[model samples]
Target: MTSNIGSPAETTQPVGISPYLSKRIFTLQFTSTPRGARLARRLVAVRLDEWGVPYGTEAHETTVLVAAELAANAVRHGHVPGRDFHLSLRVTAELARIEVSDTRAERVPPRPGRLPEPELAEGGRGLLLVERLAERWGWCPRLGAPGKTVWAECALT
Candidate 1:
């Protein structure tokens, strides 16, 4: 449940500053569980609101949904016993970026442009939803860690 909020330089910005004129970053580590996933989703909404996106705006909802899907996937697929997942959110003048890093490196998601075949099963559609909602999404090796980071970016304007 630990969280850090700041700018790229790790300095806190004034609350009333225009979101478009400055960059904001929020990073948190959560246990790889369903409850953790839910918390991540909720916190994302709260953070976006504080950044001036507001609760009911399309940008806010889309970013929160992207966070939920990424967090759930980290718990369901990339989880390792005793390891926690990480969520990093960055909002700029034109886009909101969401990154979820997990400790299981071998379970990388499908590539950015390729969509998995739709299955009739009850699961496995999370990435499809991400694809439709995000301007772009992808995964890469977790920097300085033994895992991968899956990320998505949603347009704010």
Candidate 2:
């Protein structure tokens, strides 16, 4: 519930938050750089471990990869000088949601299953990975803000 996503040290939950609900959500903002993307992936993995999902498990592995791809795309295609990208992970009894938001709202990724035919020689396969790993994925313009958010969901049950 707290909007403190600017750095790793600022992960305090809001006042009076319930412990059960607090563990279900995690959010952070990072510089729109490769290091930031890497941090996004690492942090999410650590959080999953704390939540009992643990690394190396199917749920943890898929969610981490999905977070990495989204974060990398945010840095590579959605970077805007001085603007940072945001990451949010939410888990429930039956599902997990990963969301990455960046300042470049105009640079949304290709829709699911709409990647260019035959693939490219040098790159352009990140979303394809998300499509294969996530139960579903999509993007939307940041509500009441500048930029967009790309989100992927996975079933835990």
Candidate 3:
């Protein structure tokens, strides 16, 4: 039932009790590798475009960048041998969320708003960028899974 990156299959589901407020969801699993991370980013862009955000809009660009950062982190830090990372994109009338889940439970990302000092290192600032670009970002244990899900939310206007 999994869809390919070139043509991501979207499932529309109601987000709340109000029937007027519906959300579109796209979910896919990719290998925990650099190539898979890149594919995740590209697929996110495509899915957003299909969802009416288009390709060059600010909302589209911001969401795509956030997805790229999360995917990269999943590949670099949360990767587990032979386990694939999961990407989920959910878009509503006012918000778009990007979630990247990996199979490494012990390597949860730092809490949001308490970002590490930028002067401490030359690298490892992906989450910092995510925080700056995303309206809000955070991580939590994945339900029914063995790892964590790092999510970034962008306001759609």
lDDT of 3 by residue, 1-157 (tens): 1353324223644345442377788888998899999999998898788768899999999999999999999999999998999999888878999989998999887799777788974578899899999999999999998999999999988
Per-candidate TM-score against the hidden true structure: 0.89, 0.83, 0.87
Model 3 deviation from native, Cα RMSD in Å: 3.8
lDDT of model 3 at residue 113? 77
**Residue pair clashes in candidate 2:** none
Which stretches of model 1 miss by more than 4 angstroms? 4-19, 120-122
Q: Weakest 10 consecutive residues, lDDT, candidate 2?
A: 1-10
Error at 144, model 1, angstroms: 0.2
Write model 1 residue lDDT over 30-100, tens digit each, in one string: 98999999999999899889777899888888899999999999999999998899999888879999999
**Candidate numbers sorted by TM-score from highest down:** 1, 3, 2
Model 3 misplaced regions, further than 4 Å: 1-20
Q: Give lDDT tens digits, candidate 2, residues 1-157.
A: 1245445423444468654455377888888999999988998999888767778889899989999999999999999999998899987656779999888977777777777664562577788888889999999998777999999998765
Candidate with more favorable, higher TM-score: 2 or 3: 3
Go through the candidates in order and give the C-alpha RMSD of each one to the true structure.
2.6, 4.5, 3.8
